[model samples]
Target: MIWLRKTRLILLMLRGMLICATVFPWASVAMRERLIRNWSRKLLKLCGVEVEVQGLAPGQPAPRGAMMVANHISWLDIYVIHSWHPARFVAKSEIRSWPLVGWLCEKTGTIFIERGRKRDAHRVLHHITEVMRDGDLVCVFPEGTTTDGTEVLPFHANLMQAPVAGGLPVQPVGLRYLDAATGEPTAAPAYIGDLSLLDSLDMILRSPPIKARLVVGQMLHPMSDNRRQLAGFAREVVADLARADLVAAAASVSRAHQVEAKGADQPATV
Candidate 1:
C-alpha cells in the first residue's frame, strides 16, 4: 500500500512540476502562490504527513519583505513551508543541478548561493535584498545543513546580512516532526548526515504518518547594524521555540501513555 501511494505521489509530483514550469511563469503572483500552496499541501498529504501550525494567527498576513529563517531537517522542509506560505528560498547552488527538482525550484524563484565563495555571498545577499525590497518573502536555513529535527544547529551569521542590508524584518520559524501514532518526536523524516536522498525517501514512505508542527516566532525588526547580532538573536528565538516544541511533544506522549495504562488497568468488558 505504501509503495503504491508513493508511486502515485511521484507521478503526480512530476505532473505538478511540468505545470509549474509551463504555466506558472505567466501566472499572477497570487495565482502562483495559490498553486504552490495547493501543490505542497497535496504532496504532504500523499506523504502521509499532517501539518499543524501555531504562533502565526490564522488569516494573518506574513510580513512583507521579510527574511524567514528556519531550522533545516528533511528535504520536506521546503514543501512544508510552502504549504503555508510560499516564499523564495535561498538554497545551495548545487540544488540548481538536480534533475527536475532543480528546474521546479528555479521556476519558483529560489535563490542559489555558491557555498565557500566569499564573493558569492555578497552577490547572493544583494539579490536577496532586492527580492525583499520588492515585497517578497525570502527564506533561508542558516545552519547550512540538515539536522535530526530535535535541536537547532548553530546559525551562520553571514546570511543575516541580507535582512540587514535590505532593512527587512527577520522572522524565525521552528519546525518539528513527531510520530503521529506515538506522539513522540521522530527522525523518520530527517535527511541528515550521509543519508542518500533515495534512502531518506524510502524511510519516510515506510514509516507511519508524521505530524509536522511549525511555530512562528515574533518578528525581529532589523534594528542592529551587526549581522552577527541579528543571527544570534534569530538563533536564540528559534532555539527557544524548538525547546518548547520538544517539551510539548514529551508531555503529549506522557499523557498518551498514561491514558493507555489506565485503559489497560480497567477490567475487560464481557
Candidate 2:
C-alpha cells in the first residue's frame, strides 16, 4: 500500500513541480495565462478527473480584475478555479508550508493568508488590493474551512475587506461532485485533512471515472452587506447548483410560460 501511495506522490511531485518551475516562469503574465490554462488541463487529465463548467453564461469570461468568492470543498478546487480564471489562490497559512505544493504555489506567486490573525489578514488584504490595482484577479474561499461538498459553510468576511477597498465586484462560484451516470450531486466529493495529494490521486487512479461540476454563478456587486450577508448570497448560489443545467436553460421556459398565459382568453376556444 505504501508503494502505491509513493508511486502517485512521486508522479505529482515531479510533473506538477517541474512544469511550474521551468515552463511556467519564462512565460510573460499574458503568456503565463495560456501556459497555466493548458497546463491545468493537462494536469487534470493526468489526475484522471474531468471538469465541467455549470451556470456560466455563454461568452462570459472570468472578470479581468475581479474578486472570485468560491466555497471550500476538496483541495483540488484550486486547480479547477485556476484553470478557469488565471489568478492566485487565497490559501490558508498552513498550506504555505506544505512540501511540494507550497514550493509550487510560491513559485507561481500564490498569496498566502493566515486566518484569525488580525495583522496577517490586514497584510493579505493590502497585498491583494495591490494585486487588483495592478489588474490581477484573486480567488478567495470565504468558507474558511473545508466541507464535504454537502453544504456551504459560513463566509469569513475579513477576506472580503480587500474587495471593499475598491468596490471590487465579487464573483460567487459553487462547486460540487456528481455521480456521472445519475447526475446526482453528493458530498462524497469533499476531500479533507492530510488526504495527501498523492493518496487522493491514488484513489482516483482506481475508482470509476468521476466528474466535477463547477458552477460559476452571477458576479455579485460588493455591498454594505456584512460577511454574513455575503455568505448568504454565496449559499444561495450553491443551493441553486442542484439543478444547474435546468437553471441555465429555464429563461426561455419562463418567457414562454408568460406568453402562453397571456392568450388564455383567445385560446379558450381550443
TM-score of each: 0.88, 0.80
> What ranges in model 2 sit over 4 Å off?
1-12, 186-189, 193-196, 225-227, 242-270
Q: List the residue pairs that clash in candidate 1.
A: none
lDDT of each residue in 1-270, candidate 2, tens digit only:
546545655686678678777777576898877767666765665555588987767897677677877777777788777777668878877887888778877866789877678888889889988888788988887777787776676677777777766666666677777666677764444677767665666665565556777777666555442445554555555545534644642443344334434533343342
Could you say which candidate leads in TM-score? 1
Off by over 4 Å in 1: 245-270
* Candidate 1: residue 112 Cα off by (Å): 0.4
Task: Give the Å shift of residue 210 in candidate 2.
Answer: 1.2
> How much is the lDDT of residue 229 in candidate 2?
52
Model 1 C-alpha RMSD vs. true structure (Å) is: 13.5
